[model samples]
Target chain A: MIEVAGGRLIAELTVRRPSFTLDVSLEVAAGELVAVLGPNGSGKSTLLGALAGLLRPDTGRIELDGRVLTDTTAGVHVPAHRRRVSLLAQQALLFPHLSVAANVAFGPRCAGVGRAAANEQARGWLAEVDALELARRRPGQLSGGQAQRVALARALAGEPELLLLDEPLASLDIDVAPAMRSLLRRVLRGDRGGGDRGGNAVGARTALLVTHHLLDAVVLANRVVVLAEGRVVEDGPAREVLTRPRSPFAARIAGLNLIPGTGCAEGLRTHDGTLVSGLLDAGVSGLLDAGESDSWDGAPAVAVFAPSAVSVFRQRPDGSPRNVFAVRLAALEPHAEVVRLRVSAPPGGPDWLDGLAADISPAAVADLGIGDALGDVLWFAVKATEVLAHPSVH
Target chain B: MVGVGLPVVLWAPAVLGFALVALPVVGLVLRADLVRLPELMTSEEALTALKLSLFTAAVSTLLTALLGGPLAAVLARSRSAAVRLARPVVLLPLVLPPVVGGLALLYTLGRTGPGGRLLELWFGVTVPFTTAAVVLAQTFVSMPFLVVSLEGALRTAGERYERVAATLGAAPATVFRRVTLPLVLPGLGSGLVLAFARSLGEFGATVAFAGSLEGTTRTLPLLVYQQREVDTDGAIALSLVLVVVAVVVVAVARPRVAEGAQ
Candidate 1:
């Protein structure tokens, strides 16, 4: 069984360049897929390098399967070749000189297996990736998708216990992503042969997949860890973390409207004089409730909900829900299949209502023609189940 | 008009440069003494010099590749201070004059040199003025070209491919042999050809150390030098042979090396 018990990955590395310092700490469980989400200079690639044993952590410990790979405290550092962890970066860097079969066979040969035996094993892996037909072809001959498959087969051929995938589909075109995702799912699940003994399967291998793409995490990862400013801002089940994010970075990635406020039984009182009501928990609401509740007089909080959950109507409806607001359509922008409508409510009622963001389907938007008028009154409603309130220290 | 003219203007110098290079080769072939070519080919001295040149150049190239391939790989992969320190030292022979490099080799392997003293005390053997000394001197001078070229190729080729091989279960050494070495084959091949060509034309180092023996230490270039003092036609014939051998080597190696480089 693939198990990582208390395998802490703590790194305080300081790489001093002309500008910037990469300092990060991380802990991942076996069978968990943590996505190190960040912008370009967010130390994501550097953190992956440190984890892969390509770069040494100035002060930290990296352990896999309860074995100490790197621990500055006890003075132990394992070289990359001995780490037995597979790292597949953005580019499917297959050896151009060797044939696909030979490239796959490379690991087996290096592990001291006989040439014939390594080839036999490599052939099986090639077949698993559905690349057996191109086994004799060099990497330069394969298409982007085909080359990535060969890279996957080569990585899997070694039967490594820990798998590391760094934006494996980043270089692929949009049409190729779904197919590659499925292929990666199959490989990571250990469904194709070697019988789920090690790797990222449920009972087999453990994996750490790093990617900036949120959709990839939703499709492939079971657990999602959102990294912001080189720190774990939010970490939990992929669905919960992606849908209902706690951090602003997570909120941004999941496309949710997050506002800092105080929670109450009636609603959340935002700092900008807006009251958001219909929350689930009274204690959390009471803690953030601002209206004469002495316990939460000077407390901080955050109210968050999906833009999709906040429905916008052109006119005020008779007998509307409690969280309804009459707002002015400040701006309307098209985003893929949906249109993001930014509305501003009348000032002085509640602090946060000054700015309310809402996302509606293109069909709904077109039918309503919300883009026609800017200053027109737009009614918006949010369900209690859709509203989430948490403490906001900032 | 500017777009079309810009390319032509930029390319004219390059085209002219190639024509200038081809001029000397064409002149050499046109001016060759065809009537005496057959007589020169059958001469015992000419045959001995050709054979010795071929044998010594081949042996030296083989030795250079055998030693330089791993050294290049080490230099390419290592980041240690020792490796960094040794890289310039390994390339020293390439930049040094062939005669000076030969002197350095002599001081280390000559009759009264430290290594030579140990060899005499233990086995009573001296290295100077011998065929083996010629091979050693040629290898010493030619090895750095192979190492430098191969090392540069290895650096540009990167370590990602090797890591991919490792993930596929290939061991470190296996990755080098099967993946790393093969990827850099074009550079290595070109380096080998260059080393062989250098060794074939080697004269300063050979004369300084091996002392120009007729059947042993005398290579084609040395033979040409010796013949120039006595017979100008014989020297021209030897020079023609050297040119022909170089052309053959380039013809055979160019396409394959180009393909590998790609």
Candidate 2:
């Protein structure tokens, strides 16, 4: 039998909720799992709701694989069930009365699959999620993780062309999250744990995952789309966008330092008139596309780099090694395995420089005994080759 | 903690309030002619009233289910302020005196009111003084119980599961039949029982609108009320039976609380 291949999803829709509004236009290739990462109320769920046809967009079109799922002007709109798109909500709302297996079978049964056949298909999905052992139990008897597994199995049993996940792991315990994420990866990759790739019932699924966890994008998605205040602030390859973010939100989530500046004829200059002397053209090229040196004639650019590349010193070093600047200590926050110091920009700095984070080892923090007594200032410098400057989209 | 052991003063009224509900039924049972109960209950008038009561109440319950289901669902899901604001109007019959309810139905469907005239002009049908009028009167007084119960259940159940079911390839009808209906079945069951019990004991509206005929509208409650004029003993016996029926209905519809919200 010939498979009627699923096509890419292209949406240029504006969803206007009473409290929020999301306007985005993008396309996702078939079989690509794109992670939509944003903070709470940033229209991440709104995007998923519109795509799943749960909430109709106030305007614009949503075409999935050339099929017009929503087109306001053309007056074509498909409701949820007919749209062939499935959504896995943040909460695992399994049917309380139905057994785990029956909940899984519900989707197929709705498609007019016979009772026995639907039950058989349900068992297959249950086995895939490793919840076959708990198939006979009702939702009330299952743990949160088990119920989520059944919910996921139920969603896939319908064989949707597009699958939307709204923080599938947000409700799980922190310790149980890793297992669920990995399960999501395996199912999304269509490789059931035995390296049996073709065994997935939902073949080559197109999925959009809304998440706040960077780990979800790092592990499960090949691309990332970040939103802020109901706007698409950034979208690019997962690592590039995360590592070299143009916006502060992405930089914070990716744990990177972004220095805002403008690209001029001579070189890149910080907004506060700090001529960052060390960064080389070669290093900044990696953050931008090929025509960086020529293209960025005069544009708002930001220097992006990992916090580890910054060297902190108690006093002004004897020699200006590469680039040197003094930053006033604002506050201290503990990050994983390291101490992150929030540093205020040298006085009279631009708005973006108000909060700059630098990470140093705990031993260094204690040895320096950095506190209000030490004037709460640290002299930090970065090597020339480590400074990466990219144009800030905002 | 401060109020914990206040006194017998505080506890006496609270305890009495609890006992007050069962004491009256207990008194009726004690005064009933149990020795002659079998003979008294199976008399011609008693049997006619009991059979008519059961048949009319059953039909009324069925009507409540058919009409009240969609009304409850819409009230549960609609966002219109007008629909919400109409709750008191729908519930008026429940709170109104049964005699007032009978009078309202009588005026609206009698011989000259707009509703009555419309039906009369359209189908030459006179609503009052018929067996069908008995069912209609019973429905007017009892349907609000079903609507209120089912509406609470549907509101608590909410649209979450229905939305999930829709995304999972279930059409609108299928979602209602397969997911929505089963989720609210317990509520529906209890509501039906409440409506049935209400209809079985319906007295004021039947007497006022349908009128208490021998084999037409004289339900069990009517029989008990009339037996007091002739045989007070039989009236106590019939009253005791209605009490038993009420108890059975309550026992059958015992709340299955705390089953799934965990």
Count of backbone clashes, every candidate in sequence: 21, 0
Against the native chain B, each candidate's TM-score is 0.90, 0.91
lDDT of 1 by residue, B34-57 (tens): 798879765899999999999999
Residue-level lDDT for A374 in candidate 2:
29
In terms of TM-score, the best-performing candidate is 2
The CA lDDT at A155 in model 2 is: 87
Tell me the DockQ of each model, to 2 decimals: 0.40, 0.73
Identify the candidate with maximal lDDT.
2
The ten-residue window of minimal lDDT in model 1 chain A covers A1-10
TM-score (second chain) of model 2: 0.91
TM-score of 2: 0.88
Q: Which stretches of candidate 1 lie over 4 Å from their true place?
A: A1-27, A108-120, A190-204, A259-283, A286-301, A305-333, A336-338, A341-388, A392-394, B1-16, B85-89, B92-95, B104-123
lDDT, residue B141, model 2? 92
Candidate 1: CAPRI quality band: acceptable
On a 0 to 1 DockQ scale, where is model 2? 0.73
The C-alpha lDDT values of all candidates are 0.76, 0.82
Quote the positional error of residue A208 for candidate 2 in Å: 0.9
